[model samples]
Target chain A: MGRTSDARERILTAARTLMLSRGYSALGVAEICAAAGVPKGSFYYFFASKEELALAVVEEHWAGQRAEWTRALAGDVPPLRRLRRLYESTEAELRAGRESCGTVTGCLLGNLALELSTRTESVRERLREIFDEQVALVAETVAEARARGEVTVADTGAAARALVAQLEGRVLFAKLYDDPGRLDALWADSLALLGAEESQGAV
Target chain B: MGRTSDARERILTAARTLMLSRGYSALGVAEICAAAGVPKGSFYYFFASKEELALAVVEEHWAGQRAEWTRALAGDVPPLRRLRRLYESTEAELRAGRESCGTVTGCLLGNLALELSTRTESVRERLREIFDEQVALVAETVAEARARGEVTVADTGAAARALVAQLEGRVLFAKLYDDPGRLDALWADSLALLGAEESQGAV
Candidate 1:
């Protein structure tokens, strides 16, 4: 049982890494198994199909990210400051990824969302749920900021969506240019999007 | 000569359609040729490789989009108004795509950028140039707006890049949700990014 569980974890890890750089449709189960250092039979024992494996990867990646997001946004600091920390963390992750992989791998969810949304129904539904959760997480922060008179935006949901969209867009550029520095504008951009005063010192 | 040129056009069209729905890595030359109603041998006659074909598609798509962007950005309108027109046109394009295809295909450049950026260096370079051109086009208008005191953004280039990034981000959502209405926030988001007044008549 221990060995079986270990193989499953390895498959998920390999799929996430492969999907980060190459995307979904381009990946193959055999290649994923090879990258995971597991035999082909173990792949089927773990995932019924490639799409199922993709779902497992997505879930695992989001589980880690959600933890980070919760920690970043739940601090006692100002709401806007917490948001800044989120962006800072994102940039730092991209930088770390570039150093380790020699390329910006981008947000796994965004990359897969664009690549598989139209082709795969199950993945599309799963991504929608994940992104909705993300927007809600950010919306909670925006609502806190609004309550404290830190932001002028009226619709917290819309504001949060815009911030997430901006993050994804900037991350897209970061990956495209292989330069995580593209995200430097994210904090300022978020402040502007939320109608927060620039004097907040979050930057 | 006319017959040969017609075949090339068909291949490009087929590839564009397929790439929009399925993306690049999943596509094959034989399938593209089959969709084009041309012989597989003819594919090699016009393009050296799939990468070259992708380059041609990018160039052709950019030529059309550049023309549309120029028309939308130029003329007797205010700079902010012109920017609104650009967003409106983008939404309209996405809507039209969804109407015809029953799914939002998204900005071809953005879709390709996220999927191919890390894996394909040539596509990455071309996408960078294209996005830079897009940012430059928006920056020119931003500089104009700054001169007119319509926007408060200090760095026109950064502001423009933020607007473009916001756009690609929104478009990604539109595609993921298969809802062109996802772009309704773009004009508002752009105004925020540009630090333009909410009272701007553009919205």
Candidate 2:
């Protein structure tokens, strides 16, 4: 069962890579199978259709982000410091032009929110919930900041959405310019807006 | 001659609308012609190929954006206010559920940047110029804010890129979440960063 499940996981990962490079519409199931080294016949045993496979792929991506953020941000570091560290690591890779998932992932769910949301409420609803959860997590940090008086966040909900918006924007810039400097600038401006004492920390 | 040329312009508009709604890859020439009510022959007469048409559509979109920004973001109002007004107006329209162009138009240019930059230098170079132009324009505005002492910009170039990055992200947000509130939240954070007094325009 473990070996079989590994095949399923590998197939989903291949789909993710292809979608990141070629986009959702251009990615094909056969391509995933080839990349994953899984037989075409085996894919249906694990997933129903290309869309279902794509959904699984999206779920996997979202889970990875949440887990990563949870670990980095919820660790012993201060809330503000954690946010800075996360963005700082992103800045280093972008500046170095290393292989990274800067911003353009566009949210697998957010991507679906655009392409699939109106047509399929179930998927759309899933996306909405994911966004809500991520925002809530960020909001918890903001709430902490508010308590500490590190910054004046009159609206925690609005602040969380704003951070998401900023991060989302950075992704587009990173992808659009193919030069990560675009995102580095966003990192600085975000830190500045949050009234952070350090600008050099992000880069 | 003007009437015939006007029809050509009409064709370009239709292509842009389709690109924004459906994205560049998914939109077909026939579909654009149908939307424009322009004959297929007319489209080919005005443009060499679908890729060529994509370039033109993106170019026209940028032109309109420059004009819109100049008109909407200019005035006696403070720099921060003017820009936020521009953003807020866009937000109001999106919240009302209008298929506005700036959000997605899938940025035929950005779509090209993401998909074809490595494979097609001709496409990449042209799009690069557009992105640079966008960055420069925002830098100029940051200089304006700096002149007024309304904001302190240590790196005008970075600030410019971040500003545009924010807009690009807001566009994706509009597509992903289909919500304008997200954009407004971004606006609020940006204005705050620009040193806008919270008392005057607090969201």
Query: What TM-score, over all chains together, does every model reach?
Result: 0.98, 0.82
DockQ of 1: 0.87
- Residue lDDT tens for model 2, B129-200: 888886776677667777877776677777766776666656555656665555656666666556555543
Residues B64-158 of candidate 1: C-alpha lDDT, one tens digit per residue = 99999999999578888888899889999998988887899999999999999988889899999989999999999999989988899999999
| Listed models, DockQ each | 0.87, 0.39
Which lDDT tens digits does candidate 2 get at residues A1-203? 98899999889888877776556656677888999999998899999987787678778888887886787677476677777666665565445433554333433444455455434445656777888887788788877866777757678877776676677667555655566555555555655566655633332
Q: What TM-score would candidate 1 get against the native?
A: 0.98
Worst 10-residue lDDT window, candidate 1 chain A? A194-203
lDDT score at residue B78, model 1, on the 0-100 scale = 87
Q: Tell me the deviation in Å of residue B120 in model 2.
A: 5.7
Query: For this target, which candidate reaches the highest DockQ against the unseen true structure?
Result: 1
True contacts kept of 1: 0.79
